[model samples]
Target: MLRYSAFSRDPAGGNPAGVVLDARGLDEREMLAVAAEVGFSETAFLVPADGGFDVRFFSPRAEVSFCGHATIASAVAHAERHGAGGLRYRTAAGDVDVVTARDEDGSWRATLTSVPPVVRDLAPQDLDALLAALRWSAQDLDPALPARTAYAGAWHPVVAVRSRQRLADLEHDVAALERLAAARGWTTVDLVWRQDATTFHARNPFPAGGVVEDPATGAAAAALGGYLRAGGHVPLPARLTVLQGEDLGRPSTLHVAVPADPAAGVAVTGAAVAMP
Candidate 1:
């Protein structure tokens, strides 16, 4: 059976993730089929491991290295089963450590540390192709952030928009963008807008995953946090909130913390509630 939760929410706003607590007997084909059937942006499958759990993430179209929202959902599910605390996940990408706790309101929250991240500037031609796919002009992009490719567990093209309205009016050529992303091995086109010094708005276009958009993207957020920290855009020990899925009405909020250590992974925290 599959358990569903909209992470970073009280059963309402947030990205919906599917969690399979017992995924021992399933093979890769079975997992893919299950994810397709679930039809969420991603699904987390957990199997027994040494003192912790082995996890895998699958999109409707294919398997991914790691997925942030699904990870949060899985951790919360594990917490509900084993009691709220800390848990380590051995994922396809790498080892991810997560801590789960219950708030005063009895809501379960989970914080996950990402793998080491990196950011690189996108090639001009590639950026142009991506812009064509999204119907966004170079003028629409934010001058400060520029276009770059970032990675935590998966690769995503970070495109900062000048305004939230540009982010909200997302319309893209799916097949064309899918081909571009597949050729580049990119997971998603991370569209973002800086709302303030410590707040941002984001929209993720995930054509490669066969999803039109992601309401909340944990991996991309981790990458963005790393990028910002490395570029010195935000100060050390800063906690930034990423508001996403607002256009879709899911309205997910992702909290990310960046430390001074460049080698350290970003910390992403959010609540996950079981869907009825």
Candidate 2:
């Protein structure tokens, strides 16, 4: 049976992720079909491993290297079965170490450390084509945080908008964006609006995955955190809050903590609740 869990909240909200606790017999096509049937942005399929678990992520359209929200959901589900603490996940991208615990508020929270991240500047022609597909002009972009392609476990284009309104009004040509993303092997387009140094708003366009928008994107948040830290955009040893899905009304909050170590992976923390 497929289990549904909403990460970063107590079931009522946060990003909903589908978890298949046992998926030993499923192939890629079966997994993809399951994910589509579940109807979440992504689903986690877990198989037994030596001391932990082997995890794979599948969106509606295809398999992905890694997915943060689904990771959080699966970890919490594992904790519920095996008791809460540290759980190691061997994912397609790499080995991800996750810690699950009960917070003071009695909520189950999980933090996942991503793989080493990289950021590359976007080409002018590519950026122009993306803008045309999204119907966004250069004037809507923020000057401080220029456009770039960022990757932690997956690749995403980081587009910083000057205002939240621009981010809220997300209407893009799905086929056009999908072609561009497929050509570049990008998972999603991270549209962001910085409310302040520590607070920001975000929206993610995921045409390649056959999803219009991702309510809460832990992968993109990790990439953004790494991008900001690498670029010296934020002070070291700082934590940032990303408010996402507000425009979509799902309203997810992602907490990102940046460390001083350059080689360290970004820490993304959130709570997951089981869906009834």
Candidate 3:
């Protein structure tokens, strides 16, 4: 298994993912075991197909439909071992297209296009339960961005808070959220604070992954981009930046491009480095 940190130029800064580039013979049980042993939020298992490869993402506890940080790590690993190019990942959620290239500074950067996104309004009861689990009231929320459940491969509930401090001081009932997420088919509960037209700060609690919080969440970022475009929160064809993991001391930067077409997939870009 190759270990890599995605979304940060520094190895110690980004979210770490385990990449199993060749898993042609491994079954779901074995993959789950490996992911559990790795103890990262998620791990990628790849089986070489006709052109690109069929990939699977496993969290420590369960198999998630998609995992963005692991995908970024796997693409960079493939680019380094083989060469820089495009890759098609057939995941359980959907097909993801990734392009990897070496940056001018000699680091590998990858851009992954998610599946067509879908956004839904969160039910009042579910929203109330979510806020209660998060220890946040309706008054703590940002009026501009409403509560919604979004999907761009994996499903995430996006909640935008009014201030950065509210986002930073995130404390949640993990067990309650895990049960709620299992019932709602949610991968992560995204808590965010909008900084400006193009900048935001985010924190994701990934109870489904058997992790308290995900340091860098590319999947959530893409879903948020879709939500913004669908809700007309940001200007069409916009470039947005999501700052994450600062509270965890592993700062991560995720660059997102949202198109005018609400049916189109969002693009997320980040860099990955090998972990020692």
RMSD of each: 1.0, 1.2, 0.6
lDDT of each residue in 142-256, candidate 2, tens digit only: 9999999888899999999999888888889989999999999999999999999999898888887889988889999999988888778899987999988778767788899
Better of 2 and 3 by TM-score: 3
The count of residue-pair clashes in candidate 2 stands at 1
**Positional deviation of residue 139's Cα in model 2 after best superposition, in angstroms:** 0.6
1-276 per-residue lDDT for model 3 (tens digits) = 999999998998989999999999999999999999999999999999989889999999999999999999999999999999999999998899999999888999999999999999999999999999999899999999999999999999999999998898888899999999999999998889999999999999999999999989989999999999989998899999999999999899999999898788999999999999
Please identify which of the two predictions, 2 or 3, would achieve the higher lDDT against the true structure: 3
**For residues 148-250, what per-residue lDDT tens digits would candidate 1 score against the true structure?**
8988888998999999889888889988999999999999888999999999999998987899989899999999998888777898988999998889878
Question: lDDT for each of the candidates?
Answer: 0.89, 0.88, 0.94
Off by over 4 Å in 2: none
Show the lowest summed lDDT stretch of 10 residues, model 3. 164-173
Residue 87 CA displacement from its true place in model 2, Å:
1.2
List TM-scores for all candidates, in order. Answer: 0.97, 0.96, 0.99
